[model samples]
Target: MSPRSASVNEELRRRSRERLLQATVELVGERGYEATTLADIADRAGAARGLVSYYFPGKRPLVQSAVHRLMHMTLSEALEREPVTTDGRERMARAIDAVLGLTRSHTTLMRMHMAGILQAEGFIQCPEQQRLAFLLEDTVTRYGSEQPEHDYRLLRALLMGAVVALLLPGAPMPLGSLRAELFQRYGLEWELGTPPQDEEPAPR
Candidate 1:
């Protein structure tokens, strides 16, 4: 058989990395961060254990990238979902809902991710994270921000704060309240995006 071309090799590598990320999300979500090992992730991905180390310096970075990938995918889907519109307010609303929704849907994985961020490693600026940043920046631009980069940073910080608040142990705030604050900040109507079934809480 002929040797694989460079493009084929690159594609293969991409698929391998994605499998590891997907496996990391699944295993960590199921077993929690401490209980899930790199070997377990490799086995779940059907790849060599060494590949995990090759792609990531350690378990923390690997899990961080995996969570970022999940976030990017979730945000992309929400922005491009059926009945899509380029309306900035709508897109911003979708973006907020997308990240906030993850806290509820992937509570364990998200909690672990937040914990990792607080560690010495800080935020991992991996490709998956860059992609997520790009999407958010674009949303900020569409939302008519004069300083998109600055606004993007502010938006990201707010979302992160909201996520942390929702995941706070034994003292979690209500999701509806968080959503309300975000919508008010962005000038989004309560009807935009996928609002929770509960009535919007009155302003504090």
Candidate 2:
């Protein structure tokens, strides 16, 4: 057969990167941030050990990218869930729910990611994070923001604050209350997006 085309090469590279990121998530989520090492992540990804150094500067960046990938995928799926709506308010509500849901479902991974962001390393600013921001910004625009740039930042700040509060070590806040506060800020109803499954049904 003829040599593979440039497109094929690019696709292969993409798959390799994705595998590494996915492996990072699996390893870190199962073992916690401190316990998972780059070698372990590369092994789980079935990639060469040197490839870890080639793809990421170190464990923190790899883990950050992995978590961003997870968050982006979660929000994307929530936005496109069954019976999708065109209403901006509903979309914004769903976005909030999706993020909070991640905190509950992936507490260990998300907590580590939050700590990484707040630490001296600061934000990773990787492709995965940019994609997550783009999706959330789109949600803010859909929410009928008069100034998307400003409103998106505000929405992101609120969400981050909520996530931090929810994941704070030794003092985790109530998930339902956090979700309700975000929903109230946007005038969203309780039954929007992926609402808290653990919450008791509200009485009529």
Candidate 3:
């Protein structure tokens, strides 16, 4: 057989990287960050241990990219879900719910991700993170922001704060309250997005 073409090689590398990211999410979620090792992630991915280091400088960056990929996928799905509309407010609502929902559905993974952000390594600017930022910035633009760059940063900061509040040790805030605050800030109707069944209408 002839040597693989460049496109084929690129595709293979993409798949390999994705497997490592997925494995990091799974193993870290199941075992918590400290207990999960790089070797464990490689084994889980069925790839060689060296590939992890090749794709990421360290476990923190790997985990951050993985979580960013997960967030981007989740936000994309919510925005494109059936009954989809280009309505900016609705899209914004879905975006908020998507990120907030992850806190509940993937608590451990989100917690670890947030913790990693606070570390000295700071935010990892990988492709996955860029993708996530694009989606969020697009959402802000759709929401009629005159300055999407500034608005996007503000929206991100708010979401990050909400996530931290939700995950705060022994002092977590209620999800509905957090969601309500966001919705009110954006003037979103309470009925918008995937609101919890028991969520009350935002105070007028």
Best by lDDT: 1
Ranking of candidates on lDDT, top first: 1, 3, 2
**What is the C-alpha lDDT profile of model 2 across 75-184, one tens digit per residue?**
99888888888789889988998888888788899998888899999988899999999998899888888888888889888999999999988998888888887777
> What overall lDDT, based on C-alpha atoms, would model 2 receive against the true structure?
0.87
Which candidate model has the greater TM-score, 1 or 3? 1
Q: How close is candidate 3 to the true structure, as a TM-score?
A: 0.96
Q: TM-scores of the models, in the given order? A: 0.97, 0.93, 0.96
TM-score, structure 2 vs. true: 0.93
Worst 10 residues of 3 by lDDT: 195-204
Candidate 2 weakest ten by summed lDDT: 195-204
Residue 16's lDDT in candidate 2:
89
CA RMSD of all predictions: 1.7, 2.6, 1.8
Q: Write one digit per residue (lDDT tens) for candidate 1, span 1-204.
A: 345687788899999999999999999999999999999999999999999999999999999999999999999999999998999999999999999999989999999999999989999899999999999999999999999999999999999999999999999999999999999998888899999886565677
Candidate 1 regions with alpha-carbon error over 4 angstroms:
1-4
Model 2: colliding residue pairs: none
Relative to the true structure, how large is the alpha-carbon lDDT of every model?
Answer: 0.96, 0.87, 0.93
Candidate 1 is scored at a TM of 0.97
